[model samples]
Target: MKQRLIILSDLCGSEKSDWLIYYTHILNQKYDLVYYDSCQLGNVDTSSNDQQIIHQQFVEGGIRKAISQLIELEQNPIKILAFSIGGLIAWRYGLLTGNIKSLICISSTRLRKEVYKPKGEIELYFGEKDAYRPPMEWFINQNVKFEVIPNKHHEIYTEREFAEEFSLKLCNIQSH
Candidate 1:
């Protein structure tokens, strides 16, 4: 049987324009890839609530719910690949659930706080031009492994080739 791999999209739900297709394609070759859209996972009321609050609640609550569902699924040794704010959610889930084997976070921050601790191997990728680079002190203090791509941003994984390579790396890691 193929290993279970969970791919969390950006704050928005699955859109044809996003990197979901690329990552799913790569993992489909060797694993049972599951796509979780962050938007649909939580209660988002952007009409009246402050945008930041909506986003915060969405990330934190959505992650908690996702972790609960994953635990119920009883999939052993799950790996998570998350994008943008979804990465922060994954980090929080790792801290709370302790079920993730490895996590790949792309262009994500806001996980520097003490509340969000990663319990699994974390590979953080940020664009050199990303505006939201967490301070080096944060990574140093948290002891997280990170990498900076040459030119990209929150939507870097939209590129098919990059997503494929990233998914392959995750698969390889999962195999070991």
Candidate 2:
């Protein structure tokens, strides 16, 4: 059986970004990939049609739902790739659920206290120019591997080449 990979996108979800397409291609080469768009999974109220409101809903409700889904899927340990606010969700969720085999986060802030330490390895990628970089203490205490992508923003991994390289790294983690 192939390994599983769950990818969580940022505020606007997978449709708004290219991360899904690129990463899915790479993961599909070696694993069965599952894509979860945080906005859609949480079923946040979008009646107002405001981007900020939608994003807020993702932070408040979507993250929780995403974590619950991951926990429910724990029968099959999977590698998770999260971007931006999605990364924040993954961190908190991983700490709480402790089911993922590995995690790769991009340009995310540490917003909540960690309740569960990850049993799997964690890789965090951040841009030097991103505004939301967390304090050194946060990363240092978590023991997460950090990578600085040059000239990247909050959405650095959205690029096809970047996603491909990232997916390869994720696959390697599962193999080892």
Candidate 3:
């Protein structure tokens, strides 16, 4: 049987997530995949394309609401591949539920605000050029494993090459 893997969308959610096919094409063969749109989960308005406006909503209360909704929806141990704001949500879910089998967060820059580390197997990937990404000291302080892809920017996960490489890595991890 295939393992269940939840994929959480970035802040822009499904509407702007055409890039998702890059990961799904490879991951689908190895895992039973589920997808969630962060905008819907967080009750954020997706009508506006302005990032600042969308982000403000999450900061106001969307994130908390989303976490509560997620807790209600999921009851079993989970593995997650989350991007951007979705990564933040997944991290909080791990902390709240303590039921994460594994978590992979990419370009989750908002994580810099978190003070506590969730209990689970976690890996964080960030682009070296992401100015908002947490500093190396943050990872060391949290005792979390992480990687920085040299010469890449915050949206590297949306790139086909990066997605393919990560999908392979994810497959290896699942096999082991």
TM-score of each: 0.78, 0.80, 0.96
The residue pairs found clashing in candidate 2 are none
Candidate 1: tens digits of C-alpha lDDT, residues 1-176: 99777877666556434557777766787878887766555444445435476566666576566556545553466688888767776776676668679888887755655445657788888877777777678878778799878877756777887787787786674422
**Candidate 2, residues 117-140: lDDT per residue as tens digits?**
566878888876676776667778
| Model 2 ranges with Cα > 4 A deviation | 46-50, 73-76, 110-117, 171-176
lDDT of 2: 0.70
lDDT of 1: 0.69
Model 1: worst 10 consecutive residues (lDDT sum): 42-51
Best by lDDT: 3
Report the C-alpha displacement of residue 52, candidate 3, in angstroms. 0.7
Better of 1 and 2 by lDDT: 2
lDDT score, candidate 2, position 18: 54
Global fold similarity of model 3 (TM-score): 0.96
Model 3, C-alpha of 31: deviation from truth (Å): 0.5
RMSD of 2: 3.7
